[model samples]
Target: MLLLNNHTMKSKIEKSTFIVKLTAVLVVLMISIISCNKELTDRKDFSNNTGGNVIDAQQQKVLYVIVDGARGESVFKSSTPNLSKMIKNGMFTINAVSDENGLSATSWADMLTGVDKTKHKVISEDFSNNKLTDYPMFFKRVKDNTSLRTAAFSISPALSTKLVTHADVNTSLPNDEAVKTATLAELANNNAAVVLAEFQGVDKAGAQYGYDASVPQYAAAITNIDTYIGELNTAIKARPNFSKENWLIVIASNKGGDYPVIPALMDQTLYSKPLLNGFVILYNPNFKSTIYNKPANLNSLPYLGSYGKLNGDTIASVDAAKSNLYNFGTTGEYTVEFKLKVQSFGTLNAPIFFKTSSPANAATGWWIIHNGSNGTWRLGGLASAAISTPTTKAMEVNQWYNIGFKIYFVGTVRYVQLYQDGDPIGSPTVITGRTVNNSEPLVAGYRSGFGNSATQFITDIRIFNAAVPDAVIKDFACQVLLDSRHPNYNNLIGYWPALDGAGTLIKDQSKSKNDFVFQKSTQWLSFEDYDNKFCIKPTPELYKIVPRGIDIPRFILGWLNINATGFNLDGKVWTPIYTNILK
Candidate 1:
């Protein structure tokens, strides 16, 4: 299945590219014909230029229903006849979480765009903070393809205005009833093919009362919404052509309650994932409620050794003088690398790894910090010393990333470049501040004197006096690193392979023998790559998905390297697809 091998992939992309250009020509001719001498019928053609240029019917149209702050437990166990029936008859997941942490804006944007906050650039609720033009919603996607698509958005007035750009009908109302009423009108009167109806009552309940099942207001909110869900389903079934049309009803929540994922982390108890704990229900006539169990392929690594466990500020402490970080002189040319798996982000701005004596005194030191304001990695440190060319997105929990930095000097101008999986994030960045040369023990995991605690698993740490070559880094990111016997091992100042789970100390394999012994006095857990593996298949067929109207079969996008010239502006699907209605 996959055309992943270089030869077949290249040729397929070329073929698809040509087909898209040819179809664009066909679409244009059809459009010209439709424009001239179109019978000016009295029927309100809700059709706009934004409607899909290549209109055709797919197996099903979508009705996206979102209930804010509805927890999985509340929704699944609530006494709701209609939702219960739908769940029993539908393909659903009760353990689903918002794609990003439970932030409403980021969650909805990601769901709508089928991408993450990194791609969509929506970190918060403010519409101005979004970059939706580059990453658009699915409705806009359908509309761009053909006019056979008609969409309606019945949403909360206070929250979203930018979600709809090409929809034929957009309504904003005060309450769920008003939103339901508008949605009903669209379903009954208008031939809208796709719809999004969002209600915020459950979230309001959680914000007002508590998020637990025992909370009366929260329970009441769920009960009331269940009634409204029944009404909406009834309206859809009552459609004139309901028998002919295939409809897919999707019910999901953006997030759960306001409780922080990790209130005050300590031990493994302090560790918690970014789980939103919401439900997803997909209902259609031809579907049965079933669950698929598979390995967690959240982009993991082959576990080679026991990871460094840090609870509170407790580190695998080496004597101050023995630290490679401490012994390095004024020369800033070196590479520090580790395979990192974030189990918990204790508090915002807590350091993952830093060599500085104090965070405030970080004017002379460098850090790889979590910048919460933007939910991204801050490569430089303090103020002007950090990378100026915009940082990359923050690390997601429960995934493995080979993260590190190359601190090198150019004519005494210190530049520290950040790398993930061997590629540069921005550019070779400059850190104007020089190292303070402190005996901070080259702190890994959590730094000292930080109130907020964090949980992480790190291994295969290497502080090379010379930067590791890009090829070596890329090929062996998760593999066993260079040892003392290797030719290039002399460049290494400190190397902790973290091999062998049972040990009194983590040995520095690269000649120095500066090992750190256990101080926490507990079980040394073996390394296991507990990463979440989603969409890990190499088969190209698995990635195929036709945009609603595109006549061409869904083809692999990533491996084939098909450009947007063969697709819509966002490269979602091949555009100018063959269809008669475009004209």
Candidate 2:
């Protein structure tokens, strides 16, 4: 049986005490999660991102819904018309992970902190075990930075008191209907920037009967919650200034239930919640219902990939015109980055990067040339090139790598630091020549290298005037926040995203004069497919119990009818699976 939340067991008991006092312990834990965690001693108001005096931008708001014990399978399989509509019009992933600890407390901790139970330290219901100081909740992150108001509403009293922290308004009520009413009332009163709402009846019913939807009480609970969800949606849309407010409605489940056993021998309790990756959806009118999925042949490392693909044909070049963009004057401290995959080092693969006195003469040019005598990356020169000391793991071909080069000068000697996929390669190369001249054009792709080491794709190419630290370079390798949004953007001289898939002029996102010209269009082509890069998506949980066809009222013509907008979950035209259109 799988363990939930990856928490360490306190030495397996000869037998569990669950059968004796399960109800009492569960009730206690639930109450503790809601009311027990103490206030962090070092709590501070979130730092302001902007002044209150400035005309506020079109406000963004969130209606965060936590549906307890609503297994991933029940969402689409059972009748959740409202949720189904939201999934169709927004971004959703049924693969959101719950902490391996399987308890409501563990799941709640992760939901708040965006961390595993180990980091949040909420393995059980003991609030004293919470380490919110280090791993603060997302609500705190929101409240601290923006002028936007935030609130938390929950049917469980302890949730608003114990689990939730730092909100402008918080209300704990008795039931789902009450919570929904309060949320709606608040929306009408003042447009709260954020509202985190929780419904507990589903879990309460699951505990009373069985969590599987086949169990009448559990399915009934789910149906009732769907009704409340519809009401909440109506309230959100019915607000006076709804059009001006961009609302993000998110629905997520905590732990799963113990119904619909996958296999008889699998110890359903331990495996149930862990197997369910859980359901989560971010619904917004502007959201394109695209679901990101991992590639079939994905490696362990995940990347958001470049802004677009940079097709590297041997003939093209991105010449940084003499705008002094690439010139690392006298101090000679600069960093250049590229996520690249070399197809083949043909007969003459000499230079991958160059800024020289001239192209033909070898007098002075800074080069990170590929294909040295040892096939090791090196600082290129005519003869005395300093190759990487030696690496058992040299640059492999055909695989993508985030390569960074830091060049600096001390006295007359030039120092070159090589970072292959964010790690320092071998040792820093010490070269004697320092090309202090800012005369030559900064040329990429068509270098005077020995062989034709054509780049298959060059994405996220960034050049900085100052030497960037190894830590920042490592961090940037995995992040795709892009040029201006990047923490190091101000110093970033040139950033050419070759991933637009359909561009002749490679736009320099850094807004510098350095842009590239496409020569022989047929030789290279930008590819927009993300299937090549590893996807960052939740794990899919696909087990559920669907009740028999009850033929419940579908609300075909009224506001309850999801098809009134004719939008499918993928935002395609709504079409019933069966031939009968008048279902």
Candidate 3:
């Protein structure tokens, strides 16, 4: 009976082992099938949109216009009839803000490459490095993919020289008259995919003369560009191909100049304003919606856990582990909640603050909210409170605190409400007496009251179009932080860079410039001998005299020792011209 029982156990164990092996094989097969399916799906999606091995349909006719040194306010004020019509029909970002540096090469390069200057490495005018050729430009990438024709006409020498190099046909014209002629010719050809025209006479005039003198020229240039744009539109409307083919017209600026130096005109703070510097217009006949939100928009209240150390120079250290949601809808309400997992509590305790680009125009206007970590919240204009304290009792490190706030726009006025955890901290803070409306970008983070490093780990950031109720906020907080059962609980978007292969620098072996340089073989040939054989040339007389119709130089013959027992000057061992030899 014992022997029979032992045999039965052994048989069950064998069956279990077989089942495990089968399961492993099935899992591998499933994974392989899923991967193949994903590839097929991607291919199908691309084919449906791009016409399956055909070129991009929308790139058939594209017009790009750059208005050099036109301020955002000036763009709005000026009577650009054609541009106005485009704006009315197309989409525009009223509160668009650029980098703080305002360098022309940097911004223009950003627009063309779709990458910021931080990545492109094109910072200033004096940057003359050949590194710009390392990354493919927009035109270069598009040109490689399609057979579309391209052209550019520009007034600014810098724009004409640097930006136009990637295009197929480019003309560096000085004025609008020349630009109009070139543009008309390119449009008439019916083969142009992109026609870019840049007008810079206004900026040039401003630099030479005063701002007042340049204003008229700027206006005249605008009028001319508008008239020509209208003419082009009319021409396109007349063409039968316009209905069938897709086209996009983009108008923008490189940078805006100051009026104080050029002319003692109205002291319009172009530098202080955000959107005043530049704007982008997208005109597509097939455009379904005028406004298309960028994939990763700026969060209404972006949180920076540790924004630089107390004495450090770093402005803010963003937590790449947190979800940053950018709201694209116009002038709505938003709320952000974050838990501060304090490691150590010390003096200099203050509530987390909120800031926006409203008061100081798009360039400035950093409004703030006070002591958001605690129950009491304060909302004030830029730089109103001290973040440091002598006592360490207020903030105890290693303690967790909940902070949240609400921001809503009432017509042109924006209101703020502060909350600590689930409780309302104080009265609704109203920022009033504004010359302008709420058309600025919003940012949020911890403030030391002064400039101090915010050393706190924040989690559970949520944004809403309308005001979120206390119950919903509590549920979201519990779902994300307490219970950890939120659908997107891991903040997956924040960690996407690691998954999608973006955070790491991928080495491209196909790029010849990036290929490894192997050391020259020292055994085969010395550097001096290689140079002499390749760099030195034989005389015509020496070239004509050889056994196998090959040249045998006297110097080389002496060096080679033709008289030696092993040496011969026949077909087997004839002196060959190094220049004629290909490596």
Candidate with the greatest TM-score versus the true structure: 2
Per-residue C-alpha lDDT of model 1 across residues 1-583, encoded as one tens digit per residue:
4646777888989999999999999999998877553422211122122222212243235677888888776676666688888866565555454543457777677556655667677776775667778777655656655453455454555345765556676677788878878777777864666777888888888888877567788888988888988888898889877766656677777767754333443112101222365666756554445432222332333344455576675566577677655434556477878766667767756666666665543444555655542335555443355553244445677676777877666786876677776677776755555445666666565565743656766677877887666776665564555544444468877888765477567887776778866566424666544333211222222122312111111211111122224333322332221112322
Better candidate by lDDT, 2 or 3 = 2
Q: If both were scored by lDDT, which would come out higher, candidate 1 or candidate 3?
A: 1
Each model's lDDT: 0.59, 0.58, 0.45
Error of 3 at 514 (Å): 38
Q: TM-scores of the models, in the given order?
A: 0.46, 0.47, 0.42
User: What's the C-alpha lDDT at position 166 in model 2?
Assistant: 79
Count backbone overlaps in model 3.
18
Tens digits of lDDT, candidate 2, 1-583: 3464233353333135554478788888987775433222112111222332111344556777888888665655677888877766665655454556567776776666555555667776656667767765556656555566778888766567667887878889998888888887777766466777889888888888877767778888888888888888888888888766656677778767765555543332222343344676656654445453323332222443333222344433555454466655545578888876655544444455566543333545555655542345555442245444355646656566667678766666667777876777766766444444555666556543344445555666788877777877776675443645456688777887665445566667785756765555424343333323332232222111111000000111111111222211111121111111110
lDDT of 1 at 474: 62
**Candidate 1, poorest ten consecutive residues by summed lDDT:** 548-557
Q: TM-score order of candidates, best first?
A: 2, 1, 3
Runs of candidate 1 exceeding 4 Å displacement: 1-59, 99-101, 260-275, 292-459, 462-583
Q: In candidate 3, what are the lDDT values of residues 244-298, reduced to their tens digit?
A: 5555566666656655443432122333343234555655443322432221311
